[model samples]
Target: MKELAYLNKFFFKYKWQLLPGVLFVIISNFFAVLPAQIIRIAFDLVNENIALYRLFNGFDKQSLILDIFGSSLLLFGGLVIVIALIRGLFLFFMRQTIILTSRHIEFDLKNEIYNQYQKLSLAFYRRNNTGDLMNRVTEDVSRVRMYVGPAIMYTINTSVLFVLIIIAMLSVNVKLALYCLAPLPLLAITIYYVNSIINHKSEKIQRRLSTLSSFVQETFSGIRVVKSYVRENNIRDGFAKESEAYKSESLDLVKVQAFFFPTMLLMVGLSTIITIYIGGLQVMNGKISSGNIAEFIVYVNQLTFPVTSLGWVTSLVQRAAASQKRINQFLKTKPEIINPNPNPLKVNGAISFQNVSFTYPDTGIKALKNVSFEIKEGELLAIIGRTGSGKSTIANLVMRMYDVDEGEIKIDHTNIKYLNLEDYRSQTGFVPQEVFLFSDTIARNIAFGQDQLDMQKVEKAAKDAAVYKNIIAFDKKFETFIGERGITLSGGQKQRVSIARAIIKSPQILIFDDCLSAVDTKTEEEILNSLGNVMKGKTSILIAHRVSTIKNADKIIVLDNGEIVEHGTHHLLMNKKGVYFELYEKQLLEEQQELS
Candidate 1:
């Protein structure tokens, strides 16, 4: 419940509905308890009149007694029916106000959690799996809703009804009232201990479900990899193992819940038994009338349901508390990456890295050591490096996907950290080595950079990336529906489509990080030729392992171990005969042998 207190704001938000709902519960219980009092008066009326009818002992006296009985039955029975109808009407309003408000709260809570997910940095995602994230927003929120809706409603209904019944019972016979309610204290003590067990088991069950969900999500996402390796049986076995663990935990929770209703029923039974024995003795001793005994029995019966439902309501609150704790923890996470500048210093794309160094946060690998470079406006800078030589790291840094661990990066000599992150990213075009596209029409994917689709711009970008021919070859052309990650297209086609997506942005800063690796040398040349026109007034950085891809660059930097080993134009680097020369010679020989 302490964790659930985080939702106090929502109660305040919808207080109007809840206040009226509480009033309805009170009104409904008033109508409900009034009928028992009416039954008591009718019983006493008939019992007192029986002696009068017997005293006269005549046919006319019998007729008068019959009339009296008939009138009492009609009046009291009709009142009982009318009261029930009124109670039912208020109950309907209760659900409409309270239950509907709970749904509204659910909607607000889910959106808050989703917004928090979007606000968190990539580092948060790296720490938590997609399954746990999904569960907090979906399953956990549902559990909390149970507390907001049914649990709160029943608790209110029970408390009001119980108080009314107790007041009525004491007005009849104080001694009898105290005796009948003696078992309730013991019932309360028992529930106090049982709730702790339920809470513990519920937490374990939720944790296990998160694990099971993660395993399933990962398995389905990589089904292709499993099939390719012919490991379907192994995957099945792994799923079975995880499923069994989930089942065992769920059963443990169910076992605890299984004891609740019966225990509640046993307590109800004890109260009923006490009411009969004590109430009957009071009537015989002339301490209360027979009608009073009947009224006490009816009051005990009225209490049966509200008392029994306590078991269910308690469990809901406990489970909701556990769930809200998880959701609160998720919401409380502070992102490592936040915008330092709300109003950005406008960028003109002249970028500089003065004595920059960086390390990968997740892997703890030092990716760069005192590395530096400069790219002025309208200049093309190419970086050629082997795999794992921090090639992509530079592209990431330029996009500000991460900040440097040490040293300074600047745009037009202004600190890069001072730029508004959203504005900076919006002005940059980036295509990573691994291409990704949504499951959507090719036209929409190409125009994803803009809020509205522009077919003319889409076609132009496709031509610039040299993917227009492949797109039109399909039966649906630009309207083609690609599968997830654009799986319907070939590797080279996916890369080219990704490039089209970037080109359509028309950004001031463009980064192509080994994106041309999948396409053939001829297509690569075609794209580079078109890009030469597009890059006329923009700062561009190209990361590649192939010397031929970057040979015509205005300048090239060669990296071997997270540091620049050589840098110059293609000819100068070749003349130097260093790492760049060795790589170029090896690739050139491989090409000649293939041609021969």
Candidate 2:
């Protein structure tokens, strides 16, 4: 019930449909109760010996023939017609209401989740699996839709039918009504207990279902890897375990439901027997009329349906409650990064770090320790380091992927954190080590976000990256669709395309994190030479492992153990005989040995 409260506004928004639907249900129940009355009336007429004779009275031979055909049994025939019409109308309205409400609610929920996904930070995705998030968006949301549709309306109808039946029963014979309702208090208590058990188990059941959904999604997405590695048997065994667990959990919930529903029916059966036995005695003793006993029995059966229906409705509500909790948890998670009074900064490409330090949230280990550097506009700065020397961390910080624990990063003398994230990020072009390309046309991928891209500019960038010839050789040229993750292209081609994408963006600052590592040295030099003219007056941070890659930079900063150890030009650093010089000499010797 608490979970459902969140949707009160949507319910109110569609209450017009609900109101008519409820009215139709009540009208249908009214007609349904008529059969009981017609039965009582016919029984009384028979007991008085007036049924057949009176129906045929006041008719001559000719009129008698007409009356026999036209004077049909009025009470029973009228009830049949009434019930059919009412049921038709009710079914029509209920179907329409359920369809409209479910679609509207589902649309609203998906939209809200999408909005929340946009607001969340990259850190959230780092810890969460894509398949798990997809499950919540699709499966869990469908469960909530079911609750809002048929479940809510049916519950209301059950409650109304119960009250109507009770009133009709007590009117004819209060004693029999009280006696038949004797087990109701106990039935309510039993339902409460069953509901509590079902709710607890339902939580586990939904969680297991989510896990099963995630397993299927993850396995399918990585099916190629599984096939390549010949791990089908291992994957099958793992999936079987998850599937079996989900099956067991689902069966357990079904077992509880199976047990509780029949027990409720048993209670209904017991009450029916009591109504027949106790009411029959009263009739035989001449304390009550036979027609009244018949009516009382009819109402007793009517009462049973609502009570039994209550159990199933309770189960659905419990399942919905569990789903709502999971969804709410996701909705409540505030993004790790947020702007506190943002001011958009227009960068002139001068970037500086003043005593910046950062630690990961989960590990609490410093990724960067008091790291500081400055690069003026148009400078080609190279960041060189061994793995885990904080080279990548510096790029991440510059992009504000993670906030600094202590100190400030400024662009054009303004703190980067204070700038609007979107604005700041737009001015920086980032190409990571693992180039990710969408499964789209090469032209679309290169001109990613810009609405109207200049194809000439795109061609120039591609030519500069040394990948234009490759693209032109393809069947559709720039229009060729790259298969998933650019699986259709070679590693070097993919890297060059990524470089082309960054170059087309024309950002004030470009950060290339080992983007050219996949290409050969000759191709790399060609691309670098082409970039030299375009990179004029633009700040560029090049992260690379090979000494030859960064040797041409205006300044090289060599890092070791998360701290800067050396900073100078290629010749100056070589003369210093430090870590950079040793690595450069070793790389040069390897090249010489290969040539020999």
Candidate 3:
């Protein structure tokens, strides 16, 4: 019961559909029991009339006998048909309302999980794998629906039939009814033990399945790397290992069911044997009529089905419980990054970091320490750093991907924590170092952030990003479909497309985190030249490894060991002959070697 408490919200939400469905189930079960009663009455009528005919032999009793049997048979046949028709009608409506409602709830739960995924911080995504999350949204949600649908339906059906049949059986003979139900307590004990094992096994099986799914997802996502390294056999072996583990856990669950079903059937079979032997003896001793004995046999047989169905329903309940627990835990996780203020001040692109210190989660070392900087509106600032100098960390902090451990980051003279995260982010456009594009057309990808595509704006942005000529060279122009992650396009084209996407947003501040690393110097210069007009009167931050990419910026900052070691123009940094100058000389020597 505690395991199922998570479903209370869904049950309440769909109560309108579920309440009527439950009523129909009750009505259907009631009609279902009427046939057994009809049979009993018909048998009794035949027995009594036969005795009367035997007593009144050779008289005008032939007509009476014919009338009695004829009326009894007609009433029994008509009632059977009517009851069957009513039961079938109600069963249809019950399934339509309850089972279909579960499906609707399943749909809603999937969307809700996806919505939660969107709201969660980047750290949450880092902690979980894609395939495990996919399994939770798909397989786990499906198991929950089984509980809401067939499990609930059969439980209700079994309860109603059990009560009505027990009452009818008692009315015939209390002693026989007691005897018929003697094995039920044993059956309940068996189910209790079996259910616990099943629940434990089910949890293990679901976890193994998620592991298998994650392995498959990762293998496919990095297939190119695997193939380039000629590790197909290794990957195949890894997959086989995961698949075997999954298979082993599944077989354990199957073993539990194998033990459970036969035990339940044995109990039901024993009860049926007891009822027949005892009721037959009563018939011979004249304690009960033959008709009563026959009806008792029918009632016991009817009870057998629901009792046997209990084993299956219990398994479904256990599986659903295990799945719901996983989903509940995921939903309980709150995002670490959230807007503190409902109404926040507008951003004007003026940014400042005051003695900020930060460390990554699950790591002892600080990524940035006591970093302080300010960029006035409409100024272009360039950040140059060696690998692991915390350049990307700075970009992440500016995007509010993680909060600072000390001091404050301010935008428009207000702490970023007090700003509406969405509104503040909307005012800035970011092109990450590794760009990702959807499997969509050029125009659609360019206008991805907009509610609707404006072709004019899209073309202008593409031209500004210097990718419009390459796009028009294609036969379909903007309508050309790029493959997954823009696989159909070159690296430079993908980078330009990403820039076009950001440009169309018309953000007040633009941040490029080594977005042009893939392109040649000539192409890089072309893009930068095209962006000159766009960057006018807008705050811009360019983070790059190449000095050529940021040499002409208003001011350049060089980072070493997570601290700014040089702050000046490119010419001034070169004259200082420090870390920045060393990096510039190294790059120049590499280019000269390539030409040679």
Candidate 4:
């Protein structure tokens, strides 16, 4: 019950659907108890030599006996059949309404979980694995639905039937009713121990299953690497270990259930034995009639069956509680990044970083320290540095993937924090060093951000990125489907496709984060030449390692060890004989050696 507290809002939202379903459950249980009463009446008729027709009308004994073989027996059989049919009808409605409501609730919950995932920050995803999250949305959600459906239905049915059957037994004989209920306290005590063990084991089983799922997902996603390294046997051994742990936990849960269910049945059987032994003696002593003893036995069986099945119902409830707790913990996490400004000024891509310092969460090392730079509107600024020199960090900051720890980033002389995040991001196009493409047609990938595809713009952007010739070389042309993560495309082709995607947006600012590293020198030159006209009067930031790539920029900044070491154009940096000069000299020697 404590585990189910999180579902209170869902219950309120779907009350209309659940209310009628509950009423049907009560009605169904009432009819289900009727057959026992009807059987008792038949037993009384036989014991007293009384005809059923005599009860309806005051007829003589002889005529009543004569009619027993005629219409009286038929009336008794027909009454039983009618009651059985009505009970079946109520049972159908009860299950249909409740099960459907549970399905609707499941649908709503899955969507809500997905929406939460979208709102969560990238740092949250970095901390969790894909398989664990997938299991929560699929398997855990199904478990929760069981509580709203079968658990709720059976709980109501058992409770209502228990009260009704107890009252019915009391009417037949009060002493027997008290005797039959005596074992209930012991049964409840046993169930408490069983439920506690089950709840603990069920939570363990779910977590172990999640661990197994994560292992499988990660293994398959990195299958190429595993095969390349000849680590198939090692991976198989790891998977087997996870699988064995899952199996052991599942069997433990099964063992608990095996002991629990039969214990409940034993309690029920004990109660039935007591009823028969005591009720028979009472009948022989002439305190109660034989028919009354039979009625008491039938009511006792009805009560005991539900009690015996309570173990199974409690298992479902414990599982749902465990699953709901996991889900609630995920939903309760708040994303660090959010839209702070209700109304924000528009951006024109004039970026300024003033005394900015940043450190990634969970890593004490600073990524950037006191980094300061500015790019005026329509200026072409190029950043060059060795690996881990905060080149990409600058791009990440400009894109607002993370906020600065100190100082502020401004666009168009207004703080970026005071600008609408979505609107500001819309005006900029980013092409990361590692390009990612969806499994879709080439044209769709190029026009990824647009609501509607403009084939003309798509083709023009492809042409500008210098990939149009290769695209038409395919049999399907732009309509060809690429494999997952663009597996079918070469590195250069994927990079060009990413460039096309950015170019088609016609953004006020364009960022090329070493995106041309994979292409040949000739292709790189062609792309730069094609992009010259597109970049005119637009703020462009190029982060590159090759000196040839950024030598022509209006301004070049060289970074080393999280700090800017040099700032100047290509010729000025060469004459200054600094870090940029050394890099240029090394690259020039490599090219000259290649020519020789």
Winner by TM-score:
3
Candidate 2, position 239, lDDT: 90
lDDT of 4 by residue, 1-596 (tens): 77678787888998998999999988988887887777777676776655454564664666756566446556767887998899889889998888899999899999999999887776678778999999999999999999989889889889999988988888877888788888889888888988888889889989998999999999887787899999999999999999999899989989988988788778778778888888898888898777776777777777766876688889999999999888887888897667677664455768898998888775666888898888889889999999999898888888877778898998899877767777777778899988999999999999997889999999999999999999999999999999878877899999999999998988898999999999988999999999998899889999999999988898899999888989989999999999999998898899889989
Note the Cα lDDT for every prediction shown. Answer: 0.89, 0.83, 0.89, 0.87
TM for every model, in the order presented, reads 0.95, 0.91, 0.96, 0.93
The C-alpha stretches of model 3 lying farther than 4 A from their native spots are 53-67, 362-365
- Give the lDDT of residue 317 in candidate 2: 86
Task: Sort every candidate by lDDT, greatest first.
Answer: 3, 1, 4, 2
Name the Cα RMSD for model 3: 1.7
lDDT of 2 by residue, 1-596 (tens): 78767777878888887788778778767766777777777666556545445565775554664455344457566776777787778767776876577779888987888788877876787777777688778877887887888678778778777877888888878888888888888888899889989999989988888788878888887787999999999999989999999899989989999988888888888888888888898889887778877887787787777777788788888888888778887888997777764665677899999998888776667888888889999899999988888888898888888888999999889888677788778878888788899999998888884667779988998998899999999999999999888888999999989988888878889999988889889998998998887788899999998898889999899998888889999999999999999988888899899999
Candidate 2 minimal-lDDT segment of 10 residues: 64-73
Residue clash pairs of candidate 2? none
* Model 1 vs. true fold: TM: 0.95
Off by over 4 Å in 2: 12-28, 46-75, 285-288, 303-305, 341-345, 452-457
> Positional deviation of 443 in candidate 2, in angstroms?
2.6
Ranking under TM-score, best-scoring first?
Answer: 3, 1, 4, 2
Clashing pairs in 4: none
Pitting candidate 1 against candidate 2, the one with the higher lDDT is: 1
